[model samples]
Target: MSAFDCIDTFITGGTAVIELNRPRQLNALNRKMVSEVVEAMESFDRNEEVQVIVLTGKGHSFSAGADIDEMAEDDPIRLELLNQFADWDRLSLIKKPIIGAVKGFVFGGGFELALCCDLLIAASGTEFSFPEVSLGVMPGAGGTQRLTKLAGRTKALQWLWTGERIPAEDALTHGVINQIVSPELLMEETLKFAAKIAKQPPLSLRLIKDSVNKAVDYPLYEGMQYERKNFYLLFASQDQKEGMNAFVEKRKPEYKGR
Candidate 1:
């Protein structure tokens, strides 16, 4: 991956890691940083060598939130014309699985970003909140919708209204986070988990990810139809044939992402 100003991206063990830089600022999501993340993720999604993507930051905190200074500096009209968040639409369209490795503060837009991941591995002592309401604005990036879906309407409103910090333990209990590890072991465990998923059949992984996500957006019957179609579609892939044949022959299967 090429060098990026706000983030560092690299691929290893079929897992692509996009590490947010700017530790001094707690890796705030400025327009540039958000854009770089989307671009790098798209590239990784298109690369057959990369099967999973992990998004993390290189500071004590994953992200404090969006760059408040940048937002205050920009003219509303200019910002409107620029449509910075258009990249977010593209980010959501990525087909491959995304894993968020979070630590410390995950607030406002940062919390929203973490929720966008298909899976989350958070560090113990992390604090998550939607502080935008306190600032006279609400979450503009699907935070309200996603949080309500994951943590239930009552809990989501309780936090959103108070702008209170949620401990990692509570986040885990509410199903917002998949696992919690010590800060010292955050990246290690995240990469290890990502590697496990990376080793799966790529076509199957992508299809299943898509099918599962459809459950959130589609009606029950529609989601089942989508899932059933993808389940059947796998039979046409060479990896499916190899996987079954290998099982019958008592051999390890080698998937080529076909």
Candidate 2:
């Protein structure tokens, strides 16, 4: 167990599950929690044994955003909270995949946290909103840019303007969530998905993720160029030859991440 009370991290089957443990406070993004999470994530990234990561929250909510009650005139407190988003930005550059299993309220920073994942799996009743506008502030995290990129300009504006929560089903329809499982099946399904990803060639997975993300931000020709570059680069790896040989041998490929 970690010395920190705000976050708990455990490793199972090569997957590091990072749980936001501040349940009583709705897993609010506080200074300690943010720092602990960032530390844990960095540790996970450095651990070669950890193949994938799943981030979730304990209790009824995934996260209710920053701890408003902790608001103070101190610059350190504000700076610490801001640093959580910085950690999230670094997550996008991680080689291993990260999956977010969101349930209950994933509002403000919580929603932005989910957006950081390569894949997002939410519970059927998950609720998402950007309520910072109502608080007379904008989303300090990647919510503004990520939301608009994920849900498009019109819908993103609608969500921000209304400050209304969207249900899991609606979020799925709008392309915000990839899958919605029952509350009881949340972790089960998420682990299953993570395991599936873990079985793939690690370098290939990273390259594919990078290519797709680049495609999202680039033009068609530029995206294709990016894909072509990655394709040839991956083909040069030993894993690529192993994958091909395994196919011919009618056996599963054993990727050494070469």
Candidate 3:
């Protein structure tokens, strides 16, 4: 029996979909939900058949944020305990690519979760914010770090300090989201994009994700070295030979992900 409760997971076309299932609470992230998400991600990362993972929420909202009820009940001791087992940290280390399909309210922890993804596709009218300031707290789940890195200090500071909701267009302009589609076509568009990525060679895809992440976390010189090494490494993969041969033969490459 699976341990996931707040998440609905399934696989299709080499892509795993992990949908937040708590629509009534706007798919709020609580301890259980966060744990489930991490487990699901780890499982998919180990699954050779799954080349991509799509994360979204059921119903109207992607996620409103962390569950306030859960937060309110946590004392300093419990909060400290929770910090010791930071699930978000594990989430950030996932090897496979993750695409976030966001809509409705994406605030606080929800926004942080999206930032953990490799790409984000949002609904046209999706709202994003960091309302933690208003609650006498601040984002504690890599919100400040990731947002600042993605959207520069000025935009990230303004958004975090004000705790005001920004439209999807504004989010995209600030580089917070990759693309936006109409709500009616959100899932269809996201799935289509995921399928396209899933068709790529899995080893190359993983290396690409690793190289990009290294560019963010490592010094420029070290990052360039890492990227160069990966580029050379791909030449040793079977998919590389197949890809080049397919082009010469005027045929499609059938990648075995070896």
Please list the residue runs of candidate 3 whose C-alpha ends up more than 4 Å from where it truly belongs after superposition: 1-3
- lDDT by residue for model 2 (1-258), tens: 776788888888978999999898888887677668777877888887888999999999999888776654547576776665566666677777889999999998778777878789999889999998898777876888888898899999999988899889989988988999989999999999998888888888889988999988999999999999999999889999999999999999999888
lDDT of 3 by residue, 12-126 (tens): 8899999999999999988789889999999999998899999999999999999888778678888797683478899988989899999999998999898889999999999
lDDT of 1 at 93: 89
For model 1, the superposed segments whose C-alpha errors exceed 4 Å read: 73-77
Tens digits of lDDT, candidate 1, 1-258: 567999999888899999989899998889898899999999999998899999999888889999998887677798789998798888888999999999989999889889889999999999999999888888887899999999999999999999999999999999999999988999999999999999899999999989988998999999999999999999999999999999999999999888
Q: Model 3, clash count?
A: 0
Clashing pairs in 2: none
Clashing pairs in 1: none
Per-model TM-score on C-alpha atoms: 0.96, 0.92, 0.96
Candidate lDDT (C-alpha), each: 0.92, 0.86, 0.93
Clashes of each: 0, 0, 0
